[model samples]
Target: MAVLTLVLLLAGLVLGALTAGAAPDKQAIVGSALGLEGKLGAAIAKAPAGAGAGQIDSSAPRGFLGIPGAPQVNPILAFLWAVWVGWIFSTVGAFGGIMAGVGHMTIFGLGDYAKSFKKTAPELNKVLTDCIRMANQWLVGLSSAISSLNYLRSKRLAWPLGLALGAGSLFGAVVIPIMTGGKISFSQYQGWFGVAVFVVGGFLLYETTPKGQAGKKAAKAAAQAFEKSVKEGGESAQGIAVKKWGLTRIEFSFFGVEFGFNPFWAFIGGVLIAAISSFLGVGGGFLYVPYLTSIVGLPMFVVAGTSALAVLLSMVTSIASYLNFAGAAVDWALIGVELVGIFIGSMVGPRTQKYIPDIWLKRLFVVLALYVGLGYFSKGFFGQSWVPM
Candidate 1:
């Protein structure tokens, strides 16, 4: 099953790389649709009607035969560029897509593609965002799948929580992002996204403080339970087993620890998580995993699996909605490459996670959350990155 999953992800990577880069410039597509094909018209006039082929096509092949074309990037380069994306996803269970987006807008900027949009700043920003969302969805979705499988096999997944969260996330990931008549510009998207990240970061930081030592204690206890269970039943027995599940309540046992949670509350939280993640082009791990561990009081191990499942579901919903409604174009070449790395890393991260203590995960979360949250807040509100351009 593991090998098969890896194979499937690799196949998808190749296919996405082959076609995603073939997407036409966003401005050209919209312009042609709106009957603003003056350039194409002029070019057509300049060509002789004999053997010379002067044409204008939106869905033309851009990256066939190892040639990188407009919007279509080289798969090899994309793969190299996306290593960090996969590594990050595997580690924390989210934000891989958002990180990719940030990369695309800066050092690894899509200069050639954005330059084509000479219409206006908003138009160019729109294309940039569309690329980010498209890449984010595909890259993170595959990453979540790999991680979720590993977690599920370990028996740590909170099925009831995952389902409840998925239910609300379906709408939040789909309906909310495309509600407006037109696309949201980068500034507007970033502003709202920044606020969301900032709040989540603040909460997580609080959890790391002395007052939030309850979470720390809980982590220590869970780790001890994991160790005890492993000794008693072997590694196979050191996982979560559902005791009960219902509309309002959820019950499960991890190793030797019993855990109960409010499904309805998880559903509510899922809605919020999905909304922010979908709009901001993230998998909601940075937020979801922390929420489960710190607020929902689930163990760090359990949170990883539960959040991974929820993130996959939400990404699926977000991808479908954006493509179907917003007509958002995907940077398949970039995402496909990222997916490959993500799949491999995700598979490894979960399997090797048994050795790590819970405190380390939470500490990692707190630091990353504070940094990313503040950075995003600055970018969104001030129209600049936390450090600089």
Candidate 2:
């Protein structure tokens, strides 16, 4: 699977690079887009009931369409976008949405342009949001699967944990999305998401502070000891191995250290994580990593792969739900542009992670979560992000 993902990534890179060399000129784009508009307008004019802008409205996104005066994006920029998303996902098993949002915002200011666009073409915004969600979810799911292949080959993933989490994710991502049917607006989602994750981020950040020095010191010492053992030619043996898998609970050993968790609670966590992720268009790894490490008492070494597996499963179900229930329409042109780069980035993240210490990775995760979580919270609660539409 790993080899397959790598081969696909390389092939895509070569083909995309070649195609980008002959990008269309600005006049051509205007002609094509306007031509499309003409066709759509004409088709609507001939409709039996009534034909107008309301019936055939288009909220087409700029910058991504290679239109005149739009942000110019070729395979290179798209590839880099994928690489960025993949690196974040592979390293921490999440952050794909935030990176993609930042990438899209480059075309225009995030809330400012969106608010204006939605004001003019209200219904079209719903379809556009759904399409973007589908594309981003697909990217996350594929990247996570690619990253998990190597971990699976090396037996680093805890299958029991994955199964439990995946089951819950299916419920959270698929069934729940279908039930809601896009009733939640973007700002409403943002506000709720901010309030929920703010607490998690704050708690994790505090754990790294001086007041929580005991845990930090212990984690750092363990990491240093493991590094020294490896340097002295002795196997540090920091890997997860399943000891017991059962109906209600499962137990595992990490680097000769044992831990147990209730499968039911993990499943419940998976449900909550997937519910939020399906709405937010993320892989839910940020939530999963913290849950596994802090709440479940699992070592950080095993959390990446486990979280990735869970994310992959959730994305699979969530994607189906979005298309089926949310009426999402994917932008294939944009997706093709980024898939190759994301694959490369995701594949490299796990392989290179060995050089970094476990304590450092956890620290990185906490800091990112705090920063991102607070940004979401502040914007949702106090900023102008919530456009009451």
Candidate 3:
């Protein structure tokens, strides 16, 4: 499985570079196809007997049709593009999930450690908080330095770093459960915390953001273009609302089957999940996948495809956010290594899905949800720390 994943990834990278270079000029072709022309016209009123001289002045129409270039995208190439994109996104989602898991463990574990000390030495609570805060800052700085170093290296150091971090995180996760007497550290709780954090953080960032200021300057430009479309088209209330909210519908036919959805909504959902996950230390996919499947009423297969697309968008947003706000704390090497593993895992997932019964899958989801809910309830009500119970 690992070997297959690596091969696919290499192929995707090669294909991506080739496609980027070979993409045809859309502007020239579209312009030619439309046969658009620019002209000026004037109205003339004839006086009695003959319009000996009708005044003529420069006059311009309020509008003109302009066709932009359209890329000559071959169907086969497009399908390949979709596959490669899907693979890339799935890999990133996997990375996000692992990072969220590890990060949450670190936070929760430290919190518990603080409680244990504070319980016995009440005066040390303030000191513990200060120490944790300092440690967090130091960790951020260290991660940033490592990331810079990794970027400079010829060969990626992601694998080794990932192994170390993953091992340490897993150990912490395991120990937390055992230390808590197995009563509080349920998998469900961890998943929920991760999902909640990703969702909430994403929402806050986007909602509170001043209009047209949440993303890169290019994204703002796209928003402006969309707004212009609304104005020019004289769209209806619903159309205007959708345009204002950045809704976009996309359709594709695959293997004789038609699939379609609003990519914008899916992207927003992913971003919301990613932000919340960052805060809570869990993967955003827990919420994203469920929402895509259950709420969006998509089949499991299509849900996976759509979620992968959304995850890619979310990761882009996340990377942007981290670079702007938390770059110092992120471990790029670790992310890269985990991505390799995730890529492998994601490829395997599709095959597994083919064999798993729908009933079983649904039941599994329900069980996971129940477990997480119970864990949170216990933690909030009993004030139980997340140690191994």
Candidate 4:
């Protein structure tokens, strides 16, 4: 089923790219439909540049879109690239997923088993569970912090950024497993890393505030005052109450599948995930996992599985957007190398999860979070160029 979905998604992207230019004014029409005006309209008015801008020519390849001046790679080559990249990402995602799952199982499942089995060493089970829970949260938080810093410093925060970051992280996750031969230690750096990430993220946020922008302090203050007033008003009284008690949720449907999202807050959560995911190079699964667990009151297991599932949707949308607009050529050989690395990493990642103690897991997560945060903060404060590859 997963394979079929991926195939269909790729096909749709190719078709969309080929036919993007069928109507020269399609983007204009779309902008008008969306009720955009002026500069916004102009921004949206541009079609996918390059080969995505030409008319469909039958004389071209059967599935080809006649994009003028577009660099066209052979279909066979593109297919191979897709396969390689897809496999690589899948492997990375799978490995992360498996490790996360094991951590969760340790926390909840093992604890349950200890009670049910009436084991002589049941107390050890509780300690292990706690460690895993802590590690999971810490790692997630660290990743989030890093992602946030990256986003704040970036001139442009787009979905492609997130995709690339995801790709990179996937590579890292897979590589670590291979280098260690599945004996990667979560204990060595989880907690400190998380602290570093948080620090970096906080610094980036501080540096990017409107106060830091030239001559914007007064305006920023005024805006904040206005917002505060609105929040304190009678109209906002009920709204605030509702916010406190209400379940904040976001629902969207794609490819005939209905997905639900919520985590303490809606807009902030969405923006954070979108921005950070783009910046950090992972599908934002780490952030989502924590949010779902801490705020939405979901089980750790559910969060891990659901986040992994959501990534597939994100990847498809990203690939489709790239194909439809940029029409970049895929490098199949390079993609193949990535895939091999990913597959090996994913298969081995889960095994490590089973061995790590829960307390240690939590500490590891914290360390990673801190590291990411610090990295971002430094970039923002120092004006360092921290571009993702």
Candidate 5:
């Protein structure tokens, strides 16, 4: 029954994608017939064909902003990209959604296409932006679910802390879509996204320095123990045990190293992070990573799993709000194929992460955050990207 259901779902995704591609303008016509104005339908009617002034093509491709020959995405590239996204997020417990955004906006040319409609059809541009945000959450949402379960199996996840954070995130996640959805332009979104990633990258980079490392004795000790367990091939040395749980504090031990955090502060952090993430259309793993390591003082070994749990909770609410209240739409074919890849990559990340050093995991995050942040920020605000896609 499970296999049959899965097969049916896949079939539906394929059919949906095919239908959208075959008759791209059908949805627009229906919207017009139903008296639903503004957004994509209006964009199609208003957008210029680029051939001459006032030229319009009602049958424009979805992401091309009425340019008939704008490049179609290569499904293979998208699938491969999604695989990478899943792995990174599952392994590091952050940045999966940001990377997914990069692929959707930059690699697939959707960003340029969406931005093109900003002046001609501001409503349409915002709608496309919302879709991009919605799509990013979808990939992250699935990756987070898989990563959480895998980490739980290994006893690396901090369930109590995650639950507290998730509780706070629920409120923020639901509120952001209602406030910002259908209002933000693609370029504005990109600029802010870049700024956020860049700022987090800087903070994390500082954490890697000797001065920053001075205070993180617990994290280093926990990391060493985890690495030793990996080398010795013993389950005895690997697992997280709850030491105490209270309204004010939550404590856990990993490989005999104790870590604790204030549950109240964690909940507050969750609310703020979820608001930022939902607005930016990300999983908030990047933010959670820093919070766990610096504020919560957990070692990298446990941070990934814990971050995944919070992300899963926040993403669920954010995606639901976008689809239900914001009127966002997604390309089922693209999302469907990418989801398959995300699952494969997510499954492999936890198993492979045990082999990598804790410090290296953080270093990886820094590199990606810096690079992605700089490129997107410059492109969005300056009208030209400093880095090549």
Candidate 6:
């Protein structure tokens, strides 16, 4: 797996470099962008005319999409951040997209850059937000694919449930871009993104408490058994087995512990998750993790893989819709570097996860989510920091 990851990363780097070519010269890029004024005008017809007059400064250094004075991301930092993004998602089966969003919007300074255009060039700000959202999905999409393949090979993935969720998510993913793409501004996007994560973080924190774990007896038993098997070096032989499959309920077992979920409700849950995820430009794994644990009573070992499968399917529709229908563009050069890192990080996660306790995994991300959520939410919504961040 490590060798395969390295090979994929190298190949991706070469392909992305060849396809993206060198960065365009500022004058040429500015000229080309202005040449499309007629089309750009029509695209932003929803915005008032002359709103962004004199906003274009050809003398400024080019950034993403040839925007003047926009912050240029360092490739090394982007790669490192993506590696972290892949690791978290693959390890815990959640927060990969939110972390990716944080990198694009905050770590790279793109969020502030886009927010600068909210009033002068509301259309531009919205477009940049869409691009950020789409870029986030790209990282999640690749990580989820790799993670899903790894989990599936180990027999930890729930194919029926993942596929059902994927199918249901297709509807929401497709509809969201058409309805809200090119419509959300950076501030609004950031504010809402923070809110979603913050709320989930609080819920997950409660889940780690004794009271919350009270109802999860089966999950706890399975987790303990899986942990014991891992320590004994015999877990690879133990995998999920389907006990019963019916129209109403799907039953499965791991380590002799049983779990079941309603297929119909799972589909509905998928729809709602995808709608919110697509709008937020995330993989929806954060939500999926809670659902798998709280509602379905699955152990972490199974939840990660199942979440990865669902994310893989949902990201495909979400990315295509944003690009084709929403007119969003991504920096392939940057994404290429990030993809290589993501592949490497994803390969490491599954191998190392067995050593950590299930509760610890959830706890680690919950802390991060709450901190980031509070910072972004308060700043984005109120123009002031509620936390010291």
Q: How many residue pairs clash in each candidate?
A: 2, 0, 27, 42, 0, 0
Model 5, clash count? 0
| TM-score, prediction 1 | 0.60
- lDDT per residue, candidate 2, 1-389, as tens digits? 99999999999999999889876653211112333232222322232221222222233344433211223456677788778777766775444556665455332233333223243334333444444455556666565556666666665777788888889988899876676544544444445555544555556566667766787788889989988888556777677778888878788887787888899998999999898777766667667888888898776667777887888788878887776776655547677778777778888888878988645665776765555556555554665533222
Q: What would the per-residue lDDT of candidate 3 be over residues 208-307, giving only the tens digit for each residue?
A: 3454244546677897988888856554322001111123654443334444556545444544554443333333345555675666555454444434
**Model 2, stretches more than 4 Å misplaced?**
1-96, 105-123, 192-218, 225-247, 251-258, 299-305, 339-389
lDDT by residue (tens digit), candidate 1, 51-167: 111222434444321112334555665665576556555665444555565555443545323423323333434544555555655666655555566776655677778888878
Model 5: per-residue Cα lDDT over 55-102, one tens digit each = 334344533322343447788988899888778767865566677888
Q: What is candidate 1's local distance difference test score?
A: 0.61
Q: Highest lDDT: give the candidate number.
A: 6
Q: Rank the candidates by TM-score, best first.
A: 6, 5, 2, 1, 3, 4
Pick by lDDT: 2 or 4, better one: 2
RMSD (Cα, Å) of candidate 1? 17.5
Tell me the TM-score of each prediction against the true structure: 0.60, 0.61, 0.31, 0.30, 0.67, 0.69
Comparing 2 with 6 on lDDT, the higher-scoring candidate is 6
| Best of the candidates, TM-score | 6
Worst 10 residues of 5 by lDDT: 26-35
- Cα deviation at 370, candidate 5, in Å, is 4.4
Candidate with the larger lDDT of 3 and 5: 5
- The list of candidate 6 runs beyond 4 A from truth reads 1-32, 35-54, 83-93, 150-163, 207-263, 296-309, 343-367
Show model 5 residue runs off by greater than 4 Å: 1-56, 60-71, 83-97, 152-163, 203-263, 298-309, 340-371, 386-389
Candidate 1 lowest-lDDT run of ten: 47-56
**Between candidates 1 and 4, the TM-score winner:** 1
Superposition error at 198 for model 2 (Å): 5.2
Q: lDDT at 238 for candidate 4?
A: 14
